[model samples]
Each structure stands twice: as structure tokens, then as C-alpha cells.
Target: MTRRKLNMGKNNVYMKHWLSDKDRFADLINGSLYQGRQVFTAENMSVEDGEQGLVLRKTDGKEIAVQRYRDIMMKADDGTRIVVLACENQDEIHYAMPVREMLYDALSYVDQVNALRKNHRGKKDMKGWAEFLSGMKKMDLLSPVLNIVFYYGEDEWDGNLDLHGLLGLDRIDYRMLKKYVPNYRINLIDPKKLENLECFQTDLQIIFGMLKYRKNKEGMKNYVQNNRTFFAQVNQDTYNAVRAMLGSGQHLKTVNAKEGGTVNMCKALEDLYQDGVEEGIEKGLEKGIETGIIV
Candidate 1:
């Protein structure tokens, strides 16, 4: 397992704040903009209510009470409702349930709400939702076409389990989030990210500002110049993109992310080279001493 060295720099500290605010960060990292209102509920409801009467069978006597429930709804800014259901802290029994069964549980919630609000409340048989539900039910069950997210902590999950691998939504799930919940649409928000002191320092605002500035062609060019160092650390493809932007020769107003400064990619590369050389020398000296038998 390759361990990542996390820098406790000002920017990383700020990342913690966004990480800590699970609801808030969930909106941001979800690749979905934070336009919808986030709603949490502990109350449960179903499509049909159960009666007080219970029936017993003669052959193999048994009694059961049937219940119904609906999925949680997140109302979006455009007045569209998203049906979201979360199943967490599931134990052995819940885990033993087939994926389809779990999905059915989520679907039942949507069904109950759809049936109850068909006319008097909300949009009656919202066309989009109806089609969406149908697709969920009729689609190939074994292929894993679900968007269930799982939230877990660091110690709880092994790195081998890729969250996107579990959900089969690689395009939707980003590289960072794949670290947790290796199969679900859910992201593991480190509680420590919330406690970071730098959150109050307006790191999110800075990131948001950069995102906003990168909207237009000229702005994007300037953003590349400002973030040359960061791009260099990423991949060659990313570096080439930045280089293209810089070479585009489009004049844009300088963003105040910091100030206009040379990235010195060669310097960063040199530092890495020097560190490797030092490590190699140290190892060689240790090995030589061990073999000399001068003790």
C-alpha cells in the first residue's frame, strides 16, 4: 500500500473544513453543483398503512406485519425532486440481503411517495420520475446499475475496494472519492476534515473563485498560468493542457489566487531528484557498514 503524505499546509487545512461539513462537502464533491437544498430525515413512511389485525396460517403457523416506506426526497433549485435513500451501518443481516432486495427497499419508498402524491400534493405522476423508476426495475439486475452510496471511515475500509468499482460509475465518481466506499455512490467524509482550523480561513472561497474564473477561454488561460506548479505535479496530459492554455495568447485579468509568479517546474523536479539521491546514499552507507563487521 503506497501511503500518501498529506501536507498540513494552509490549503490542505482548508480542505479539511469542506471535508468536515459532510452535508456541505457532499454537495460540492458530488460533481453535482450545490443548487439543491439538502434534507435529512429520521422519520419513515410507506406506501400503504398496515391494519391492526394479524392472520395465522394453519400448515405452518406464522404472523407477520407488513409495512411501507418511501425514499427521502431532495428538492432541487429547478423544482425537480431527487429521490435519495441511504442505508448505512448495515450489519450482517442487511449485508446478506441481495443487491436487488436492497434496491427494492429504496424503490418501495419512491413508490409510496409517488402513489400518495399523485394528485393532491407535489407533481402528480411526475413523468421523469415514473420513467426513472421503471428503468430501475426493468433494467438488468445482475449488471449492478444502482447509485447507492456507502459512507465509511478510514480504518473501516481496505484500499482494494474501489467505490466506483462497486457502483460501476467511473465517469461520475472522481479519483479522490474512490478511496472510500469502493463500490457505492457514497463518499467517506473524514470527521477530521471537519475539525480542521483552516476552514474558517476561507479556503473554499478561494477554490470557488478559481472554478468561477476558469469559466471562459481567457480566464481559463490565466488560471493555467497561476496554477503551473499544481498542474506540473499532476500528469503530462494536465501539464500539456496548461501549456496550451498559456500558449493561446489570450489576455485575461489576473486572478488573486496568490500572485503572478514563475512555476519553476524544473526546480520542483530537481528537488525530487536530490531527495532520491540522498535516500540512495543513505541506504548504501547503511549496507556498507553492516557488511564491514567493524562492531
Candidate 2:
């Protein structure tokens, strides 16, 4: 494969090496974003006009050119292409209502190009975001479908965001686009959950092993104190496997050597001591100096 490269910045200025990784991540993200459903096709990346250039083509031969200056492209597994446009930064509006106007110009040209090609393509929508609230009011949807993807993750997401209803398909202002374009579902991938799968697997497994080991040590110590015969009844292989399963040394000297479990016991005892002190103080105070005859 001739690694086809298109510069997303002026004069073919190369981005950091991580951009290649970001591009690959973009693919997986799109896949995961759409839940493994096809939603985008990516091609013709350029940035001469200020943003990268992208061609979003659908399986039916319909295509749209999304200027990358303000938008990003996501090619789906089923050959659907989604254009993600950012109009907001740091909880502030970046673009005004001019985005709806820009859509008119961009999509008008897309329609003209499609007409000339003797091929009509897939439905296209605009993904929009802004720091200030801009709307999809002025777009000429009669010419082409108009859909907007708005960035809703503002700085203070106090579970108080209503941008969805403002931009949802049911909104009266968005009725035109809903009537024309097939509304693609938008789902947020919790950034914490979307971290690398390997990181989650390894870190979680390590923590789990540590916890299991701690539990086994506590259980073994309890058994030794109470049912002393339990250890003698077990085979050598069983004993070793139990120790290995808990990620602990089998040697008697090493078992419970660190007193890690004892820390938990100590914490509980401290809580009990504090509780007893509080009760004793309260009980004496409730008597209200009765022994002194001051009541």
C-alpha cells in the first residue's frame, strides 16, 4: 500500500507523529461511537483552506465535501461518512449563527457538484459546536439536508445541560433537518471508559489480584486461629495452588508477614474506640452534674 498522505495544514506542513495515531484512533472511535455501525467514510484530507478537507461518501454514491478547517471526518465501517464540526471551546461559543449560513454555501456547492457528476450520494448533516449558542435556523434545507452535531461537554457539566433538547430532532427549529436527513444517533463515550482497552484490562487485573491476595491472607489467618485442622487436611498441591492463586508466598514465615490485613483491623478498632469515647462523654453530660446536685 502506498501510504497515501494529505497534509492537514498549509504547505503540507506535517503534524506531530501522534497524528497518525490520532487518525487510527479516529477510526476505532467512529466504530465505537456508532456502536460498530457504519457512519462515515474518510478521504481527501487537506488543510490549505484553513481546515482539513474531507470527502464523506455514502454507499449509494452520494458524497459531500466537508472542509476540514472547522470540521473532522469519520468514515464508518458501512461506508457512511460523518462530519464532526466543533463550534465551541471551553464552554464558550466560538461561532455565531454564521455556521448555518456557512452550511448554505458549503452544501449548495456540494449539491452543484453532485448534479454535475450524474450521481446523487448519501444524506449529509453538519456537526456544529460553539462557545456561544448559535442555531440551525437560517440554513436552506430545501436544497440539501441539514444536520448539526454540537459539542455538549462544557467545562461545568453539572448534569444541567439542556443542549440536547435545544438541538434534538424534536425541537421545532430542527424540524426541517429531521424531515430531510436521516437522523444519526449521537452517544457520548465517557472519556474515562474509552481509554485504551489494554490499560483497563491490565490495571483492573492487577488491582483485583492484590485484593484477592489480601482476602486469602485474611481467610487463612482466620482458619489457623479457629479450625487448625483445615491446613493439615489439604494436599501439598492444593496448599501451593491456594497460595499462588492469592499471589502470596506459601512459606509459613512469609504468610501474613506484612500485616497488611492487620491495617484494616486496626482501622476498625480505632473507629470503635472513638465511638465509645463519644458515648461515654455524652452519657456523663446527659446526667447534667446531678452528682454535684447542680440540676
Candidate 3:
């Protein structure tokens, strides 16, 4: 593949490039959210705008507009149903991720409501006051928004995983409050915790597998050797993403180019440890720990 210098700033940008592929996007959603249930496929998915924005009227009649961008978003339609799928790439842990995701989901519903209302108003299809006031018919329902937080960090996650975890409502004193407040959970996909890497059909399988050993030089080398054929011929974006997330700069220098926009990952690994396995491993780990964004 065409070798390019790694952009150390915002590695998540590289992640978006490779995972943007329809097939790979579907594969990631299926494997991460559905546990390989095959609930989504590239054929039934269409890319959607990742921007979420809406205006809300407050009790004082003042309006506020807010906007947020998702790392990736798509529409999933399966004849009888449609759902919105969004992925948020994270290099470091956000302690308030649950609350952030909850806001994104709420705004998604608001966006849909605006669209549905616009269509109805254009067609002059309102039947009653309820439809007119709400901007949608009583029976109309919003598509469910499922957001997954894809954490590629190699370190153990010590952060809370749900809204309730952040709410501090689990104590006996707040039992009554906890019973009434529903919990919102994040669909977290951590490479270190992935046990069913085989569920992935694409290079995502091998990529995630190798990520689990990112800090372990010997272990990562072995994993690459084990999946040599596929990694040895990955697309430019794929190689860039993997190397970016894995902190390969401390060791890896050039990507050995091959035919058809592919690279030999085996040779890349060889150069990574050319100075000595332990030295390379130590440097990689030190750099990863320094950033608190290991993967």
C-alpha cells in the first residue's frame, strides 16, 4: 500500500477512514452490538449524516440549539424495520461517556421528529390537534438509535458503563429514586475484552485480535504471524488505522508496499523489532502509557 507518515494527532480520524466501508461498517456493528447475530448487512445499510442537531424550547420560551457529530452513522433497514446505528471512536476513556451518549440519542430522536413533521406539513396530512401540536401523528414512532462506544484502549477500563453508574443512586438511601429512574447503558466495544473475535468476518476480526496484544510486543508479533496472509495484504486505510491505534511509531518506520494497494504486515512487524524486541516493546508501552490512550 502507499505508505504515509502517521498523523499522531486524532488517531480516531484514521479509524473513521477504514471503518467507513459499508461492509466493514456492517461487520463492526454486527459483531460489536449484536454479538455476531448478523442483524445488519452492507446491502441493507445506507450511510447517513453523522451530525445531530436540534432546537429545544425551554419553559421560559427561550430556544437553544445544540449540535454533535458522531464518528460514524448509518441507516439500517431490513424490510420490516429501520434503526439508526452510530459508532463513537474513543482513544481515551471519557468518564461521562454514558451521559454524552444519552444526549446524542435524545437529539437523534429530535432530528427524526423534525423530519417527520416537515413531511407531514408539506403534505397537509394532519388530522387533529394532537398531530398538529406534536408535528407527528399519534401513532408515528421514532426509529430507535443505537450508539456504540468503540474503545480501542489496551488498558483496563475503570470507568462507569451506564447512566446509573454515574448517578450514584445504587446506595440504599437512594433505593426509591433508583427504582423510578431508568438506566441508560452504553454499548461498549473494548478490544481488550473481546472474547468472540471470531464473530467478525472481515479484517476487523484480525485487527481486534491483534489489538488485544498491542502492548505485548512478542504477543502482538505472534498474532500477526498467525494471521500473516490477510494482514500482509490490507488496504492502505486499514494498515494506517491498525498502526495508528497500536502505537507502532516507536518501532515501525516504513510500510512494505505490495501489489494492488496492499502492504506486507509481516515485514512491517520485522522492522518494528529490528532494534531488539524488548527495547521496542518497552518504548511502545512507555509511549502508550504516557498518552493514557493505549491500544
The TM-score leader among the candidates is 3
Q: Candidate 2's residue-wise lDDT over 88-181, tens digit each?
A: 1111222332343354336544544444333212332323453112222234222332223322122223231223333565767777776665
lDDT of each: 0.34, 0.33, 0.82
Models sorted by lDDT, best on top: 3, 1, 2
RMSD per candidate (Å) reads 17.5, 19.7, 7.2
- The top-ranked prediction according to lDDT is 3
TM-score of each model, in listed order: 0.25, 0.26, 0.86
- The true-versus-predicted C-alpha distance at residue 62 of model 3, in Å, is 5.2
Candidate 1 residues 229-288, lDDT tens each?
Answer: 553343332222222222213222222222333344333333544565688998888888
Poorest stretch of ten by lDDT in candidate 3: 1-10
TM-score, cand. 1 vs. native:
0.25
* Candidate 3 or 1, higher TM-score: 3
Per-structure clash totals for the candidates:
13, 24, 2
TM-score, candidate number 3: 0.86
